[model samples]
Target: MVVGLTGGIGSGKTTVAKLFKNFDTVAVYIADIEAKKLMNSSNVIRTKLIKEFGKETYQDNQLNRPYLANVVFNDKEKLHVLNSIVHPEVRKHFQEFVQLHIKKAYIIYESAILFESNSQQQFNFVISVYVDLEERIKRILERDNSTKQEVLNRINNQWKEDKKLLLSNYVINNYSLQETSNSVENIHNILTQKACSIL
Candidate 1:
């Protein structure tokens, strides 16, 4: 089974994913991390990104993430184009990863754009992490060294919090670290049991 764990920028989904890693029965795939790697390592992605965004797309053969983010986050169409170039390769890689981890009770595919990119169907269960807007903004500002407007522009590109919660099979409220950790444990137990059941 694959569980799609997703949330908007700065919603602490990565923290929840790390908590899930404590369980022997669970394996986690972080899509954004892999996508970044692929963008740098895969020739196809590199070629397309350069074709679309020019030589500035890479510096010394590594993806210039900040330059790309600046271009796409402020332009919705450009962001879609960027995702189009990257997401499919990530999806293909994920399927191969799933085959390798077939024995695990379940896998968590944590993606920032799982819903926005129409990827929820690939998972048997989907979990949405929720943190208040201000908290999310603060977290992003602290960690990303980005301006409020830049962060807000990225946030605006995604589906709203309520929409994600409504579409998700499960929701993790991630305001407090202790409480969120407890929630991850509980959800992990539930998912493991479900994955193990004969029915």
Candidate 2:
């Protein structure tokens, strides 16, 4: 079973994914990390990105992440173009990862833009991780070398936390680590049972 896990920037989505991995039966496929790998390693993606964004899209045969981030973070159209080039490859790679973990009870497909990409229907279950706006901004500012406005710009690009929470099968209010860990453990048990029943 494929379980979709998503949260806004600075909502600790990656941290939650790591906690899920603590369970022996859970496997996770992090789309953003894989997309970066594809952007750098895939000739097809590299060619398309360079053609669309110009030569500075890559430097020294590696993705110029800062340059591209500066470009797309402010422009919706360019961001759409970048996602178009990378998402298909990430989905394809995720399929292979899913097959590799077929023996596991369920696998978590972690994407920061799960709802924005309109891919939630592809999963058997969907989980949304959430924190308030101020908390998210504070977290992002501390974690990334980003200005508050830049963090806000990125947050503006995603669906609001409330909307994602309403659409999700499970919601994790991640205000504290111990609470978040408990939520994960509980949900992991639920998913295991749910998957077994489906079989």
Evaluated with lDDT, which candidate comes out highest?
Answer: 2
Q: Candidate 2, which segments miss by more than 4 Å at Cα?
A: none
Colliding residue pairs in candidate 2: none
Ten contiguous residues minimizing lDDT sum, candidate 2: 76-85
Q: Each candidate: RMSD to true structure?
A: 1.0, 0.6
How far residue 122's Cα lies from its native spot in candidate 2, in Å, is 0.5
lDDT of 2 by residue, 1-199 (tens): 9999999999999989999999899898999999989998999999999999999999999999999999999999999899988999898899899889999999999999999989999999999999999999999999999999999899999999889998999999999999999999999999999999988
lDDT (Cα atoms) of all candidates against the true structure: 0.92, 0.94
3-59, model 1: which lDDT tens digit per residue? 999999999999999999888888899999999899988999999999999999899
Kindly state the number of residue pairs that clash in model 2. Answer: 0
TM-score of each: 0.97, 0.99
Error of 1 at 198 (Å): 5.5
